[model samples]
Target: MNVSLNEVEATAKRAARGAGYPWGLAEEVGKATRWLCAHGIDGTNSLAQLLEQGLAASLKNHRPVEMQSAWAGQGVLCPIITGALLSDRSDLLHAGPIRIQKLAVPVFLLPFVASAARAQNIVITHTCDLFRAATDGDRLEAGQDWPSFSDHTQITLGGQLTTPRPHVTRATPDPACWDTLNRFAHRTYAPATEESRLLGAGAGLSDND
Candidate 1:
């Protein structure tokens, strides 16, 4: 069934939170998912797969660490965390390309790259064996081979502009994927109690002013 971008973002945020991410990161996840869905990508499925794979268990272990000339994670890197870092440190992109190893759900990184690109007023190109894409915060272009994950990822600033693409207002997620997301999101709700139910979703059941 088709859902509005707002619903997608809200569900994604709650799902991320329920999957053990803090509110701040979950908010980012929501925006990223909305961006992907708007651009014709299966973002809910990607996030569902990531969460289902137990990647969300210990996020700290997946953080990217700087080595001699590149960043490597102790385990596979969480794209949302790494992507947030990329947006936070966008200025470093000017010095040289940033190479990240063992990144999971690499497509999730595109939204953050777009944010970085918009901040720096330049188009950013992300290249790897699985995919090649360029974004300028608004326009986006990705290869047909863009996979769900990548072993190594590299991103460089200042690429040629891509054609403006129309964005969608509603997204049609896979039914199974939507159910998976909803299950995760269900954790965020407080259990309904008799007392609360009597209150009828407001301060009281009374209609009197």
Candidate 2:
């Protein structure tokens, strides 16, 4: 059955908690899965269905063997597990972007991608195309009209997107003025007067005997 995004998120969270994942991590998984689904990855829907159907047993058993088989015919990938794997394997995956196809619940996979990117100090570009190509260690150019998060079908490293340059320019404040202000503040303070010095603590006191 088709599921709504909210339902998918809630179900995924519940499943994550039931599966012994921390609440905070479960929450993150929910959001990450939602993002992936929104990007047309079917993450939310797949996760929700998995939760309702109690697919944890399959996942646990499959994890010990070929974890990828968990989603073999179900067309539902677990984003939480995938993300965790990515984070753990960041060192190995850092050389370049990696692509996986036929991922069920693909939306749930984004956090892993993001985390992996961060761990490797690279950027991850996700493409919805059949190839599901991701770019690592690249920079996005800033653009005048920024694209919406959902609009980005392809993921890239640091430079995948760019901010728009403002056409209107404003004059910068003068450095000389700042220097003058600093000089004035310094001048406002006077050397301690004799009277003030006399009253100062330890002015006439000495430790030397």
Candidate 3:
């Protein structure tokens, strides 16, 4: 029996939600996996297909174990899981650039890369080509401007420290102009009439008493 990619995607989404990931995050994972599968990453597709097959124990067992290879050991790297791991350990990865070789389902890994970059306050570049990094790194200009993703392959990630503009400080004081206020405060009232004084409260009526 075969299943459509959409169905697999739906199932994966449900499983992710059931497993306790927030709806928004689960949705992100689904989209990431789909992107990876679209890019011909076998692991991404396999995960989708596995989900459609009911998430059997054997399928769960097939999840890729993280190997310390240059590119995930040239096997299918589950981007969904990898992204989760990266998000969890982002602080550690931020200390330096980390590389994964032969990454399976590489597209799925993009969210994790982006999350790590944002968390570490830096940019991330992932690619199969090595020479491009050296040349691009030299040619690339750095500034406070954000990086664009025109090219998907051969990623070169970095951040620019934008120089802040100097602020000008000036000394000033409030202008003096308040004849209206002075008039109001200095205004005097006529002494109360005898009839008014009799009705007035307390001391106003009885100065001597």
Candidate 4:
């Protein structure tokens, strides 16, 4: 079904939180997912897939580890965590391109990179295999071959900006993906109880007035 970007963000936030991510990270996921959808990427499915993996395995395994010239994890890296770290230490971009190996859902990292670029007032380029993407804080351009998952990727601080892609106000998420997100988001709801349900009413179970 067609939905507004705001709807996507809210649902993504709740889903992330319900999937065991801290509120702060969930908030990040919300913004990132919205950004992706606006740019015509399938962020809902990516987030749903990530949440499924997180629920099925230890998130610690996805934590990034520094290597000689790149970062790697025991398993595929979670883009949300990695993206936050990049935003936190955006200055690292000054040294050189940040290379991350075995990154899951690399597209989700774009918003974080774009945010960092806007903050630093610079252009950034992200590449994996044949896929290429670049953002200059305001505008973004990516190859049509953007992959669902990337085994290895590199991000650089400076690059030539491409023509901006028009953003949409609405997104039509895949039905299966939307259902998965709802399942995760549902975990945040509290079970209904009799007292809670009757709290707002002036009378109890039996109301004659």
Best by lDDT: 1
* Candidate 4's TM-score: 0.91
Q: Whole-model lDDT for model 4 versus the true structure?
A: 0.85
lDDT of 4 by residue, 51-109 (tens): 88773245677767774489887888889988988888888888888899988878888
Over 104-208, each residue of candidate 2 has an lDDT whose tens digit, in order, gives 444445556666676778666555443333423222212112111121123334434343123211222234432332332343356898777766855455455
Q: List the residue pairs that clash in candidate 4.
A: none
- TM-scores, all models, native as reference: 0.91, 0.43, 0.38, 0.91
- Best of the two (1, 3) by lDDT: 1
Give the 10-residue window scoring lowest on summed lDDT in candidate 2: 143-152
Candidate models: Cα lDDT each: 0.86, 0.45, 0.41, 0.85
User: Model 3, range 60-152, lDDT digits (tens) per residue?
Assistant: 332335434232422344445556666666675534555554344344455455566666666555443322211111122212111211122
TM-score, cand. 2: 0.43
Cα lDDT for residue 135, model 2? 29
Candidate 2, superposed: residue stretches over 4 Å from native: 1-12, 18-28, 31-46, 62-77, 97-102, 128-159, 162-209
> Model 1 over residues 1-209: C-alpha lDDT tens digits?
89999999999999999998889999999999999889888788888987786667898888887644887878988999999999999998989999988888888899999999999999999987757889999888874336767877898987775464567889999999999999999999999898879777676667777
Looking at model 2, residue 93 earns an lDDT score of 46
Give the lDDT of residue 36 in candidate 2: 44
